[model samples]
Target: MTPHILVIDDDAAQRRSLKTAIEALGHAVHVADSDQAGLEVFRRHRNEIEAVLVDLSAPERAGNGFLRALGDLHASVPVIVQTSEGATHHAVEAMRAGAFDFLVKPCSIERIAAAIDSALKFTRSGSQGKPVRRARTGTVGFGDIVAASAAMGRAVELGRRAAQSVIPVMLEGEAGVGKEMMARAIHATSERSARPFVTVNCAVIPHSLIEGVLFGQDSPAGSGEVPGKFSEAEGGTLFIEEVSELPAHVQTRLLSVVQGGEIEPAAGKRPRKVNVRLILATNKDLIEEVKASRFREDLYYRLNVFPITIAALRRRKEDIPHLARAFVERFSSEQRLAKPLVIDASALALLTGYDWPGNTRQLENAVFRAVVLADGPVLGERDFPQVMAHMASVRASGDTAGARSAVEVGHAAAAAVQETIVHAPNPAPTVESPAPTRAAASGDLSANVIISTDEAGNVRKLAEIEEELIRFALKFYRGQMSQVARKLGIGRSTLYRKLKDYGIDPDDPQKHAA
Candidate 1:
């Protein structure tokens, strides 16, 4: 069952964006615009809701009040706080008030998903919940496939339904999307679990030999019989990979086997009954192949009976964090690490931002490489130099196709709403100075900007100048909190508070009437 999460945030845009991102993580979300609405939703669906996400920057500090209300109601669901204020006091206060986890704003979706996963795991462990049963390693089952994204979840659900029958399942997806893995899972969960699961890649075999490799052949030397994959998987499954590459003649033979449940052991030899289940996988679009006169229409119809299309890795980036973590755990054990190495948030963010062209296979190999070279207990951003380099190259080329610089949710809005608190060095007492040169060379243009003067040529209010500087700093640093805070000579909490006080919005800088 998918976990249900309750999100309480007064900002409608934030609520919508959060819901979009969270639902992609394979969870059901219930949202509220206020603490009272949140409480009503939680109370009505307390048994189903597994976690709660609350914004700590709500008006009147409603997040803090909600925390106290949850305590009063004796709610046990883990509450994760996501706030714009990056102050130590804010985090400490939330933790002391019983937040299960704290996340700073502009947080990566991967980090939020990881935190929710941990909270759920803790809850399950506390409740003594047992994991879903699955086949041992090497025998892939639906349970072993990480379907943390809705697209993959739908595909997995289809595969599960197909596994209950002996129907021919056609898996269509890009190479490395794990079509073969899905085939294995289907076979493992089917009634043919104990039977042999033979595999043959039509694309890899020689065109002349693919037929013989699939349907068995009589020994030309008359020494004995040459058993093909179908014979080997009698009363079991035969997973034909790259099935679109099968020869025209082999397609006819495969069609016969599919329609009549029989296979020819050899040319001119009597047809033999084989109880093997057929699961064909192909990365090609069979419909296009058929239109191109490359594949048999009848064979396409036969194999397309139960089609399941696995989504590419990029289309389902929400699953990257979980998949990467699973690979890290597996490789850590394989490499025999002294301690299980964990992936840091920065590293996960880096990975989740990239569009993996090779899909899961690529991510798996990347994690394996990182695990082998890592010397520390945690894998950091430095561990993935190749990915970093690729990301840099992509950014340099202005190629949005390769990777997104950041997650889309509230990224621009967050950037627009920052404040600057950097205190400048005290000016020399009434110095007679020359005209100021461009401050761009020193990378502090905000310092040299001409202050606004009134109609009488008098200097403007200090508060007004401060607000302009804050806006300049935010634009200068590109919304990087650390850089903005350091340049402003103030802490992040102070910057956030100032931004609130000045009513600074990325869309609308000044809120007060002129």
Candidate 2:
């Protein structure tokens, strides 16, 4: 049977656009221009509809009432909330009110495709009345993760080793760096692969209730019982997010669980023995947290037994193109396009050049937006309006560093010979001429080589010639670090290091103006 999607929005054009996109994904779509009409459509075809994609900004909906109304009709079907960028607060509220997922407007088709697929999967997994656990739930393996760079590869390799044992592993990285995904991969590959994997976000839980949430609460008057996260992951893996935010009391109890493999639910209750692997994550420096008296030192030691630090997106820029291309293919396939879309070299360069502070997640979202709104068979610079807009803004603000880097990348990509579309079979690999070095490529450097010998015809030190070339390139590129670095075949970080080593002021290129 074909999966059905119900789209509700007040704007007629948006409703039509969404319906077309959803139908292109091989799903039957039902559209409603208003909340009341949408409810009628859902009620009429309730069982047929597999998922609902509704806009939360509808004037008639009146504060998540539409979502509740849809739930009232049929609670099993997933509801994906959509809203304009400004309505982020409302979107968060809708999530709290049981939204399967929330998307900001102008979102890419790929984002929509991924969300719909996940929602349907969630529905199917929980169809048997078993509650679906969001601990990424035995889906992701190490192979599923994209680790093209050595930095990320190291982190993944460490995770693989940690999976061999029940050692409490700690993942340290900036927010949105895929720590949860790493944890899930560890669990999926571990000996307890068949058991449950439960997750608890310590940051969001109320401080007072965190203890009961992690350790399970005793029934009042000794009646029934509420199982905490620890109990839920018996013989499996328990992933605690933002472990640094855990209250001191909870930390003490958690330490006991780690040390003795048992948990005491209440003050007077006897310790209940349990077997489970632990994975904790934090965005802050655990040692600093301990120094500040915010986290426990002993508990930290136990969790940090097998620490894996995932590098930030900026530090691993080499992986951006790979991750972006993967997203493009995934999202394009999900949209069910007759022909797969390919990202233009310029588009790939623009993506690779930008520093994704939000890490791989942000890059994925960017690609999703680009793939969704793309009109032609190829995604170009115009397709990524947000990225181009940011570069434009940077240029306008006189921040030559970032804007020039992106421009340089675009220029380099313009000369790239490869244009292979992903998933294309029997594609012949093309080999090209070796790329010219920075000195050869630069007009000034190509015209004349720097003198390697001193006035007396004696050969100068290697550092002298290298520094002269760098200085010449810096001046030639007019202090554009990205262009200089790329033309020289080095990373931006390495370029900066060399600049500092040579005491070359990047901003003062006039020193070598000749």
Clash number for each model: 3, 2
Q: Write the per-residue lDDT of candidate 1 for residues 1-514, one digit (tens) a residue.
A: 9899998888887888889888988999999998899999998998999899888754246266777788898887878876553231243355446666655454446546766887787566633422223334579889789865445656777888999999889998888999989999999999999999999998889999998888877789998789899899999999999999988888999889888988866556788898989898888768768867999999898888998877677655546767877788777767766566777656876776677779899999999999999988789879999998997898799875343423332222233222111111321111011111223426664465746897899989988888777877665454544456778899654775677678764222222212
Assess candidate 2 and give its TM-score to the true structure: 0.54
Model 2 lDDT per residue over 192-222, tens place: 9899999999999999999988888877778
Which residue window of length 10 is worst by lDDT in model 2?
A: 414-423
- Model 1 ranges off by over 4 Å: 1-7, 11-118, 122-137, 405-514
Q: For each candidate, what is the lDDT?
A: 0.71, 0.70
List of clashing residue pairs for candidate 1: 421-488, 422-488, 422-489
Return the TM-score for candidate 1, rounded to 2 decimals: 0.61
Task: List candidate 2 segments past 4 Å from native.
Answer: 1-138, 220-222, 401-514
